[model samples]
Target: MVRTLLALKGALVRGALAQLLAAEDDIDVVGEADTPDELRSALRAERPDVAVVDGDLVTADQLGDLASDRPAGCPDGGPPGRLLVLVQQRRAARLGPVLAQHSRRIGFLSHDVAPGRIVEGVRQLADGRVVLDPDLVVAALAVADSPLTPREREVLDVAAEGHPVRDIAERLVLSAGTVRNHLSRIMAKTGARTRLEAVRIARESGWI
Candidate 1:
């Protein structure tokens, strides 16, 4: 049997999917989680063969952490099981961080896909196959390359939320002058005359 864990944010959706997967003769619903903490706990305790996660509930960084913290005795020192992340097509860029790093054991599928597709995806993942939604692939490809460095992107992400230099610096643990310099470079890289415009450009291009 394919042991599966559901980790979507919506309780109704999670329950519905759990029921759907449980009906499959070859699949078993091992655990369900609605939050990152619960999901982490479920992963460690259940060690399901496949984990169906909602990208919004768990960030890519947190996914990386879970992958690295796989239960001891994982074959070849790799993650204990496969992960199938369900994300909206427009939000595909949010997965860029972990896509390349965990491509082998992680799959991305559009959340709007038919329930049957999700079931098939779990089976495929359990068999060590990659499943990617075409729309998500196109959306990921459409994101423009970001020119800003990691620190610049960090500043821009904060700026995108309308935070001023002082607030951004305080939140990032940097001085106001350093924040100003980062903003200046961000503007130069994105060719925006104002920080707000730079934020718009970065967001439109999915840099943040």
Candidate 2:
């Protein structure tokens, strides 16, 4: 039996992902698509065993289509192709629920996941098992209590690195006062009394 994968990626990531999936003996990288509409149509036509989607499409509609789409040929009644998202560890919290609702068969991995791990994930997904980064799962479980926004998380992450407000401002290209504002909001959201306390809260809560 010939197995296939439809790789969905942005222009910057398209070539490399295709090259990686095409090299596998059990896997044939069937096609590629950049947009959700194109991807839906392509998957319906080819019915690949898996689709490796990019990490960046976070909207509900995008995730919904990625999870289940009723293209004319591949109606809504059957089991959909397994969905594996290549995402950064930090974005797991944001992407978790959407992935979960789509199917427990879903998994997330860092963009830096080894090529072998990527191949393994695709195969596991095809076999009806979940494949996820251990660290990403841990991070997701840890961040369950955090309601932190992404910008605040970015600020807290920088602060965790021991960068003072001024340095963080320079590195992030935000003004010192703007950085302080973000810190203040971070503290308020986390209920921390000071910067160190905020960093400690974030670290302990795994919001970073």
Clashing pairs in 2: none
Q: Sum up the clashes in candidate 2.
A: 0
RMSD of each: 4.4, 7.1
Query: Best by TM-score, which number?
Result: 1
The alpha-carbon deviation from the true structure for residue 81 of candidate 1, after best TM-score superposition, in angstroms, is: 1.0
| Cα error of candidate 2 at position 170, Å | 29
Q: Each candidate's TM vs. the true structure? A: 0.75, 0.64
Worst 10-residue lDDT window, candidate 1? 137-146
lDDT of 2 by residue, 23-102 (tens): 77788878777766666777777777777877653333356556765435544456667777787776555554555576
- The global Cα lDDT (0 to 1) of model 2 is 0.71
